[model samples]
Target chain A: MLNQLLRKLIRSASGRTQWLLAVVGLSIALLLIFAAVQVQVNYNDLLHGKTNQDSVANFLVINKLLNNQTYGNATLSAAEIDDLKKQSFTEDVGILTPSRFKASVQSYSDRFPFYTDISFESVPAQFIDVNSKDWKWDEQSAFIPMIAPNMFLDFYNFQFSFSQNLPQLTQDVVKMIVFKVNINTPNGVVSMNGRVVGFSDRITSLLVPQEFMDWANQRYSINQDTKPSRVVMRTKDPGNPQLVEYLKGHNLVTDADKTRFSKYRQIVNTVVNISWITGAVMLLFALLIFTLFIQLTVSSCKDEIELLVTLGASPKQLQRFLMKQFFPANVFIVLITLLIVTGLQYWVYSILSQQNMFVSAFTSYYTLLTALLILLVLWITNRTTIRKYVVQQQK
Target chain B: MQIRLQNVVPVPLREKILQRKSEVWNTNIVFDQGHWIKIKAPSGTGKTTFIHTLYKIRNDYSGDVWWGNQNSREVTGDALAQIRQQKLSIIFQDLRLFGELTARENIELNRVLQEPFYEGAMIDEMAEQLGVTHILRQRAGLCSYGEQQRIAIIRSLMQPFDWLLMDEPFSHLDQENTRKAAALIADECSKRKAGFILMDLDEDDHFNYFKRVEL
Candidate 1:
């Protein structure tokens, strides 16, 4: 019976049934394709959209300053610091310049008596990092722009240059050390020194100008040999957050500045809403039209059906015949529609990517799963329609 | 493949009977296989309805219709249809031949609908014996009433059905074709080991060889 049904269907497919099926099939196919195109468009837009909030950037680094602190040193030797700064591996490097200064505030009166105590001893005229463009002496006229806007004041000239330390002074005031340096790189990594400089003042612990530290150290007359605790630098591009991470992996930076970043959740949600609604709606409409068509086809053949029944057909057999007629046609249409929809989506994405509107031309798993769901729904709808028709015939 | 109709009741037009009832409104005529039983009745006296009832097409009629002693009350709708397709064939009062089919096609239709009958040679022989072989290719509607009648009878006999219910199949035929149709029907029924319930409204001499019953 199945073979017979198949032969009849093939013959009908080649005959006038083809003409009728073409119109309906094409309508359904176009509707499905339109939905698929919408899905693909929305997906590309969401994926290629502006900075997603769901994404985060992280950088991992080892603390070189902390490693040196295990030896109770607050700073590297001048030669050692120079050697390390000159290494090909360093990036966006800046030195911690320790200094001290005092400022007075009126205690809500015209005659002020109290003053804040501040102190530091040494200051590097300039800090150098081979990776940071600001410290490049080769670009003589265009030195790295100082990110600190308020380093200059009326009483102080905020200027940085290469330091030529007197060997005698370096031995006496070694205790006036800059403890820790902090670098805020674009990658969200915060590198800092592991040890604190042996100083009691709160303001000196932060990244600040050398003039402020020097005034305080001279006023206090602190004289002892000490090391700078840590040095910190910022990346050239704050948006390129990966620079700190890459530097950290090479052991050139400390681990204080590590963070994590990704945009997968945002991308996935965008895809789900965009792809599923369009495809599912198209499939739903296709199913509705298919159901209506099946009903119409069976109703139109009522006379032929009666003739077969009179020729000794049972209700069950008649139901089987109608099922056989529509099953193969449905299978063919759905498979072809799936291919067309998937292919066209890929093609449109490829075309758009060439125009720089999309980052990828590939489809996600959700698209395939959506198609499968649509097919399953169609099958279930067709079966329900068949059962309804069969019940009517029995009545 | 033997069949019997016992205690079939014929009722007024509006009276309905349930499908499973054994005894009909009121009559007894036991029919066996391989016998030509002429059911004679005046107009509107239920001759055709009785034949339909025996063939299991009239569900509202009550009776014990047995196929090889198996009560028809025990069979379901599917089983009854199966019996009609394989064990019973009917020649209607109007001939009910498909006008679109050729004479040969009409005769071959039933054979195709069921399992293959393996009696193609017999069909050709019957057509020739009934003088319809010359016009077998002609559409059945274009044939003479006598030729159409003979083809209907021959078509019904081409299958392996054990019981044949024919209702006024020769109503439009002339005297000469009527005798020929009757002879051909009796000969085919005997050869196939099938019985016939022939309903006629005429005093035809062709029904003389069969057992006669009055309703």
Candidate 2:
């Protein structure tokens, strides 16, 4: 029946009814494609919220124990690291010890949005102690200030003018960036001159590799003593709730610390919800427009319908015929819409690449959910319209 | 009329005249089956309505229209449609030839709609004998008024209908074309033994073939 209808429709192209079906079918298909993509993007953004924080949480969670005033000396020894490895749930572990130091270099004065004052007390700086000698250990150094090279150069360029020829810095700088923990001199004596590396963009406070804390104090020959403000530790089983509980039982964390962790988890849930809802809304809107397009086009041909019936066409035959004409067009329209929409999204992302635009890290479920929703909309709209008018009504 | 229509009802004023009506409020006319039945009435005297009502185009009237042995009201849409296609045909005064199609195609449309009259020879014979062969392929809307009326009559005759209902089939034709159309209809109707119920305001001597009746 459908095939016969299609043949008839092809042979009768000049009729105004055929034209309406073609146009409306194409438009609705395109709208549906756009909506599907929007939903995917919105949902994906939400899923990434939790994982993004998780990336840093593996290390950040340990700090609450070590730094809590109520629970002091919560440091883990090398033996404890070995014990963790033997646990069944353990996968891999990375222990990062970042320290800070102060140093001054000629500022290049051109990369920032605003001019800087080199005349300030210290050149804003940071230093990261990447553990491996592979040089790519710099990967672990990501989350901190010196993630990219030439960043320091860009910073100096924006803030200050370079003076005459300055001392050239060597790559050997990474190896010596950290201080020897046991090294001690007289109370007022210091060892080496401070070597500043990178600075924070959000805050004016300088960032220094944790390995350099002792070295900077001794090198500057100053008596200002300071304890580590934060100590980040990574374990193989960071997500194991039992591990967290075990650590809590060990007096490794105070009640206040547990409350803080719960608060962060709540925040993660909220961010994920926001992302899913945004995607869902975008998908719903697209589907609504798609359905409306079908309705409008179908309704436009109401005037000519009687003429069709007078031609000896059965209602079911007409619908099958319309579907044959419209279904292929709709398929083509959906594909074209997908291509155009995807291309547009790609273009937008490219433009914002420098600013990390459209970057997402999400679970697959959100995207699947959104796609299912769009399909549901199409099924409902097409079924209702086709059944109500095209498949049911007669002269 | 092999069909008999008596006390049939008229359509309502609020409705478009073309739409089929279901309720007849007034009717007081009757016709018996025959080949030369002329329905003569003044303008607005429901002459067209009488013919259309019998043809089952307007069903809303209260009346008894018998199609041979059965009540027309008892016939299904498909059955009535079959009756219109195979047993009856109509000629509008305004001549409803599809404007975009050629006169030949307009005549062919009846063949297309009726029980498959696929023989092209039939169309050729009608056009050639009616002196319209030269204009058969011209767009119907562009044909001369007399030529269009002849084509309309030819189109109605092309169908296999046993009954032909005409509404002033030669209203605007020239004297020569009028005589030609009357002769053509008379010859064809006689050969087919078909019934023709014609509605006209005045009787013309050229249509002496028809047996006239006053409304």
Candidate 3:
């Protein structure tokens, strides 16, 4: 009953228009802040998520752009490889060690006589996309295992077979045949038996095991060039414009089709930054108006407060009463803004998923945490302001 | 509660009170528990100032006013509010009521300010006894001075107190109303074994005052 009467006395001092303005301003400020956080989370999910298109884009083969100034000397030094590993975009680098000797491969059967001069490259096992049980090589092994690129089979089946009037063979037919590999030594050509074990989709080269490449190169190498000309690295975002720009500035190149999201990423970054700035400014203004409104209400009820204190109303009572009136409105505004952001996030998820791009269907935890943090700030502001003005009125 | 006044005198009337003969000014006096006391003073004798000093509402006076073992000037903030809520109740000369509230609401506010000294029906019963039942729902600001004073009297009685301080509590009422109002005040005070300090201009055969002094 006393609270009801106190409410009557204090309500006449403040109007409804100022309260409505405060609620509206606070809602807009919170909405913008939460939207900025959600945008960042969505973009991060797209870059590192295990979706179909993004996984292939995460592993890029980078090499020097073969131009007139540097055609033959396009090899990457140890320092250059280390520098690539140190960049924020690149997670790991695997050098493609090219052969320094001449080699050739010939079919075992006279029915399909195929002979070709081919260069071999070896990379660390993690970068290879194909998995097979026979992908290991040692001195005691019976036959050398080789991984051929999928593009090599495609070219032979479509162009080479049509021109040479030869029949196209399937992968199982080719895998069953053992071929003769010849390495040119100082005395004569050394022969070894080898077979195709798997087909890789990433690097376009005949890949040998790292251990075999080490032993073969030491025994039969004729040249002194040890540096690799190409490298394959796993990256978090291939479409990051900074990564592309850094590569271009250093005269390096990657697949142009993979960096297609550079312009779109730049546009998204601008929108996030703009929203952050606007939210911060609006939050400041909203806090300012709320503080001024509270001060005005207290001052308008100055006479009534004095009489109340003189009549035995404690300062704590008035402070609690005033806090009860204002803090709930702030909580309500925050909840309403959260509801709006949730609806917008669901709509955005549907639209993005329609285009074969993947993002989370629900809002991220970081955005909810940001909203809670803002509510805490508002609570502190309300508490201190009420305590300050009520204490002043008591004196 | 024992109210001790040691050399208490209003600063603005310092010279005049010292020149004339007085009993409360610059005099050591104590009003013990459960004593009904009255002070009679003529014009410009600081009757309201004396009452204000006793209530600790103004400190623009010399010397000390103590309630029990603590000095009134030393009390402040919520402690002072504690004393006011639990020990002291007042009826001012101007009949200070929340004019925007109704007559019954003005009385009910004090009734529930602390723990209730009486139940919810006490307000209506008191208003009926004081002949303010017809104006119980009327705004206190729109009521006449007699009705407002009766509301203030009932408001003061709503709280438990060791001392009930009155400064011309019945100045605007008629002779019959004053008689009836004094009877209610005396009856309420005797029921709780509490005391009162009434300061006025003239003398009257009101309640049997336990102690009378000339201010």
| Listed models, DockQ each | 0.13, 0.04, 0.76
Best by DockQ: 3
**Which one wins by DockQ: 1 or 3?**
3
Tell me the lDDT of model 3 at B134.
Answer: 96
Question: DockQ rank, highest first?
Answer: 3, 1, 2
- DockQ of candidate 3 compared with the true complex: 0.76
TM-score of decoy 2: 0.45
Candidate 3 wrong stretches, greater than 4 Å: A12-17, A51-53, A68-72, A165-170, A240-242, A356-358, B6-22, B25-28
Local accuracy by lDDT, each model: 0.54, 0.52, 0.88
- Candidate 2 error regions (>4 Å): A1-328, A335-395, B11-36, B42-44, B66-83, B182-193, B202-213
TM-score winner, 1 or 2: 1
Candidate with top lDDT is 3
What TM-score, to 2 decimal places, does chain A of model 3 have? 0.90
Score residue B198 of candidate 3 by CA lDDT.
Answer: 94
Instruction: Name the best candidate (by TM-score).
Output: 3
Steric overlap count per candidate:
32, 33, 0
Error of 3 at A112 (Å): 3.0
